[model samples]
Target: MPRRGKVVLVQVAIVLSLLLVWESGVRAGLIDPFFFPAPSTLVARIGEWMSTADFWTDVGVTLLETILSFVAGIAIGTTLGIWLGLNPFAAEVVQPFIKMFNAIPRILLGPIFVIWFGLGLTSKVALGVTLVLFVAFFNTFQGVREVNPVVLANARLLRASKWSLLRHVYLPSATTWILSSLRVSVGMAVMGAVVAEYLGSSAGLGHLIAQAEGVLDAAGVFAGIIVLSAFVVALDAVVDRAEKRLLVWRPAPAHEV
Candidate 1:
């Protein structure tokens, strides 16, 4: 078999083995069903949830919030990163304030956002943007600062305009850094949305889990978790595809071969 196929097969085997063990333990009364639902029960619960329209709506809400946060964070972060990177004095002036904001635990801000924006989409998106923005900003700032001085000098000597330099020089140099941050930002975005929902929201996966937890329904909670895990995996796969397409010029590592 191809390496990828073999790897996937092994992974499947491992997961199945673990699930089998868990199910067996539950059946033998070695595990408490109330605390840890059987894998089968979780699967069934997920299927039942999927059959409902409300579940789909919750998914859509979470997805919209995640996408909004990811895009807005990247756009704003990259713009500021590039600006600060090019302007040393400005960066110095804002450095302390940026650090102060970044140092604040983002999770604690969820309630504040909910209070400001209410328990709605805006609060969730705001929370997610905070989680994602700093990651993009720091990576991009570093990338821009790390641009080769020689190349920059050469471009300037060639009479390149500022726009031309930014387009041809800074952005290309920072693309890898910016893209690398995206994978991390995806999870951050999801966490922000879910946490905000869990804290105070009427919909989304987080709300589902929160509702389940309130009722002490282990199966429902686990099922919600499984769904969220799958969602994150799907988003990560999309990011992987985008990364491969954008970095086609980059050489593949030996393992991928």
Candidate 2:
């Protein structure tokens, strides 16, 4: 077998063995299943959840917030990144203001969003936008700034119009960075939605977890967390696939499939 294939197989074996040990430990009471349920129990919860609409509703709500926030973040961030990056004066002028907002903890804005947007999905969407936009913005800005100066000079010398420069130079240069940012920001988007829900909400997995905590139902909390993790992984995978398609100019890494 090839070295990479062997290494991957070994890694999978190790993970499977660890899961077995964890399951055994829980069953033997060496670990408290109440606090940390076995993987099987969580899987069972997933099965039970699939049988009902309650879980689906919460999942849908969270997904809605995540999608809206992600779209808005990328749109706003890309526009700002491209604008600021192309104009040195603007970039320098706004650096401090951007950094100041970035430094603030996004979750703290949740209650305020709730106050302004209410306990509906809007609050969660706003919080998610706040979390995702900064990440996307920084990545895009860095990407644009890092574009080879020689390339920009060449494009300009060739009489490229403003629209042509953006399409041929700026957008292409920033594509990789923007995609990379999206990959990481997807998890943050989910976190923002959950945080907003936690602050005030009538629905969403975060709301369910909050309710479980009030009742001290560890299993339910764990179940909700597991559900959220699944959603993040699924969404991240989608982004990865889309990135590969959009950034076809990039060669696949030797380590990636």
Off by over 4 Å in 1: none
In model 2, what is the error at residue 45, expressed in angstroms? 2.0
How does model 2 score by TM-score? 0.92
Q: Candidate 2's residue-wise lDDT over 71-174, tens digit each?
A: 89888888899889888999999999999999999899999999999999899999999888988888888888998999999999999999998899989899
lDDT of 1 by residue, 52-165 (tens): 999999999999999999999998899999999999999999999999999999999999999999998999999999999999999889999999999999999999999999
lDDT of 2 at 171: 90
RMSD of each: 1.2, 1.9
Q: Candidate 2: minimum summed lDDT over ten consecutive residues — where?
A: 248-257
**lDDT, candidates in the order shown:** 0.95, 0.89
lDDT of 1 at 113: 99
